[model samples]
Target: MTIHLANRVETLTPSTTLAITAKAKELKAQGMDVIGLGAGEPDFNTPSNIIEAAYRSMNEGKTKYTPAGGLPELKQAIVTKLKNDQGLEYAPSEIIVGNGAKHILYTLFQVLLNPKDEVIIPTPYWVSYPEQVKLAEGVPVFVEGKEQQDFKITPEQLEKAITPNTKAFILNSPSNPTGMLYTKDELTALGEICLKHQVLIVSDEIYEKLIYGDNTHTTIAEISQELKEITILINGVSKSHSMTGWRIGYAAGDKKLIAAMTDLASHSTSNPTTTSQFGAIEAYNGPQTAVETMKTAFEERLNIIYPKLISIPGVKCKKPQGAFYLFPNVKEAATLTGYESVDQFVAGLLEEALVAVVPGSGFGSPDNIRLSYATSLENLEEAIKRIHTFVQNKTK
Candidate 1:
C-alpha cells in the first residue's frame, strides 16, 4: 500500500543537523568516542526553584488543561517580565502562550499568511524560519546578510527587498548561528523602513538573556510607539532560564493577531503543558542568581575557546556578543585540506577527527560551519584541538 503525504510535507527540507548527528551516534555505538558541537540549548539543568514550583503545582491539582492561550498567572508573569526588563507594557489579552517559541512562530505564520504572501528572511537564518513560511503556503524571500557585515543585513538591502507582497520581516538579534547583535541605531534605521512600508516585524528574541561583554539586548518594539505597534515579539524560558524541556514560550503584539493565534491553537495544541507553565511562572518571578551564573559560565567558555577556534589555519570568526554558537568561515581550511566544500570538511571532521559540526549550508551559507560551545570547556578544547591538528596534518 502506498500512502502519500501532503504537498506541504513534500516541499519541506529536513533539518540539516540530523545527518552529522546521526553519523556521530553510529560511531559512538561502534565504540568510537565522538564530540558533538551542534547543541542549541544550554548545558545547565533547569534551575531548582522552577522544578520545585512545577512539582508543587502538579501536587496542588494544577495538572489539568489551562486556557487555550495559557494560564492567567503565566501570562501575567510574562507581562510583568516585559515591563521590568524592557519597560514595554502589554495586556494579558495581547499575549498568547504556546508550547514553545517554535510552535508560536508556526502558529503565527498560519494565522497571518495567505498563499502568496511574502516573509523577508535574512540569510544565515535559523533553519526553521523559511520552512515554516512555506508550510503556511507563504513565500520566503531571502536577502543575504553578508559575512563581511557581521552577517547582518543593512537597511538599504531591506528596503530593496520589500515588495507589495511583503508581509513581515524576521529579526533575530544575537542570531542563532552567528551570535551577532543589531545595535540600537541599526535597529532604529530598520524600524523606520518597516514603518514606512507597513511590514510587520517578527522579533525572535529567544536568546535575549545570554548576552556578554557589555552588549545589551533590545527589542525593536521598544524603539518607539510606532515600531511597538508593528512588531510581534517572540520569547520563551527555553534559553533564558535553561528551561528548554519545560516548553513555555509566548508572543506579544496586537490583540487581534494574538486572538487569531489562540483560536488556531485551541483546535490544535489546546494549551501549553500545565506544569511547564507553572515552572515558567517561577522562572520569571523567581530569583535572579542562577540565570546570571549560567550566563557567566557561557561567556567564560566563549572567551577561552574562541581564540583557539580562530587560531586554526584558514578559519575566520567574528567574536559573538551573545548566544552559545560560533559561526566560522572554514572554506579556506577546506580548500587547503583538499576538501571540495564546507560540507565535506564537516563530514571529514566527524569521521576522521571524531568531532561533529553543522555545515553552514544548513543555515543558507555554504562557506562556513557552526560549532556550539554549550558543552563543557574541556570538550570544546579537545574538539578545537582535534580540528586544528586535522587541518595542519592535511596541509602537511
Candidate 2:
C-alpha cells in the first residue's frame, strides 16, 4: 500500500517569499551574485537596550515558561505602549501574546472559523490571509482594489462583498505588498459599513509604527465606540523594534474573544520565549528613539526607490505611504518581448539581472510584482540599476 498524506498538507502552497528565497539560495550556491528583494523584514540589528534586557533576563535565570497569555510585565508594557503611541486602551487581561503576528492570526482563524465560514479579505492582501483562512476550513472572499483607487477598496466594494456568512474582514493599514493605508475618512466609511453588517474586524496593525509622512495609523476600534467592540487589533514589536527574531506579537479585543484566543494558545504553543518577553518589555517600555531612527531610514529609502522604479520602462508604481515594499504594476511588462505573466517577468528578471522579487499573484493580484527595499543603500542602488537595465533590454 502507498502512504497517504493529509489533504490539508497537500493543498497548502509554500509561502511565496520563502520559496523565492530558497530559489535565490539555490542560484547563489551555483556561484551567482543574487540581490534578494523578496524579504519582508528589517535589515537592522535589534536595538542594544532591548538586547541588554534579554541578557539581563538570561543572567537572572528567567529561562522558564511564562503565562500562556504572556508575562504580566510584558503585557503591562504593551498596554503602556499602545496607550501612548496609538491612543488605544487595553488592560493586560484583554491581550494575548503569541510567537508572532502571523501565529496569533493563524490561531484566531482556527478558533473562530468553522467549515465554509467566510472571511472578507481586501486584495491585494497579505499572502498569508487567504492561506490561513483556507487551512481553517474557511472561505476567503476578495474585494479588488484598483490602481486608480491607490489599491484600497472603497466602502461600496466592501458592502457588496459581504453576505450573511461573512465572519470577519482582515484589515491591514500600511498594508504589506501594497503599502496602502486607509485615511481617517476612509476608515470611517469602512467602519460604518462593517458596523451595519455586524461583521468583525481583524485589524492587523503590525506596520503601525512604520507609516510614512502624515499618514496617521488609526485602529477601527478608535473610529467609533460601537465599532470598537467588534475589532481585534493585532500588533507587535517585530517591525517596530527590529526584533523579528524575538517573535513577540499580541491581539487586543473583547474579553471573551481574548479569552478564547488565550485558551487556544494555552493548548498550543503554551507560551512565547521567556527571555524574548523580557526583551519585548524593554522594546515597549524603553526609549522609542531607535524606532524613529529606523522609520527615518525606511522613508529615506522609499524616497530614493520610488522614483527609480517609475522611471524604468513599462513600470508604473505609486509611492507607498508605509511599509518597505514597492508593488509596481508590470502590465506594460507584457508588452515587452518574451514576457507574459508577472511571474515570468519576475523569473526572467531574476535570471537576467540576478535580483529576486515576488510576483503579485501570491497577493491575489496579477500584473504586478513586489520589490522589498529593506536592505542597505548600496544594495538598493545596485538593484535599481540592474532592474532598469533589465527592463531596457527586454523592451529594446
**Cα miss at 137, model 1 (Å)?**
0.5
Candidate number with greatest lDDT: 1
Tens-digit per-residue lDDT, 1-396, candidate 1: 999999999999889888778888999999998999988899999999999999999899998999999999989999999999999999999999999999999999999999999999998999999999999999999999999999999999999999999999999998999999999999999999999999999999999999999899889999899999999999999999999988889999999999999999999999999999999999999997999999999999999999999999999999999999999999999999999999999999999999999999999999989999999999999999999999999983
Model 1 off-target regions past 4 Å? none
lDDT of each structure? 0.95, 0.89
Task: State the local distance difference test value for candidate 2.
Answer: 0.89
TM-score of each: 0.99, 0.98
Clashing residue pairs for model 1: none
For residues 1-396, write the lDDT of model 2, one tens digit per residue: 999997766778778888889999999999999999998999999999999999999999999999999999988988888788667788898889999999989989988999989999999889999989999999999999888899999999999999989999889998899888989899999999999999999999999889898887887788777888889999898988999888999998888888898899999998988999999999988898999999999999999878888888888997899988999998786567467678888888788899999999888888888988889878888998998888887784
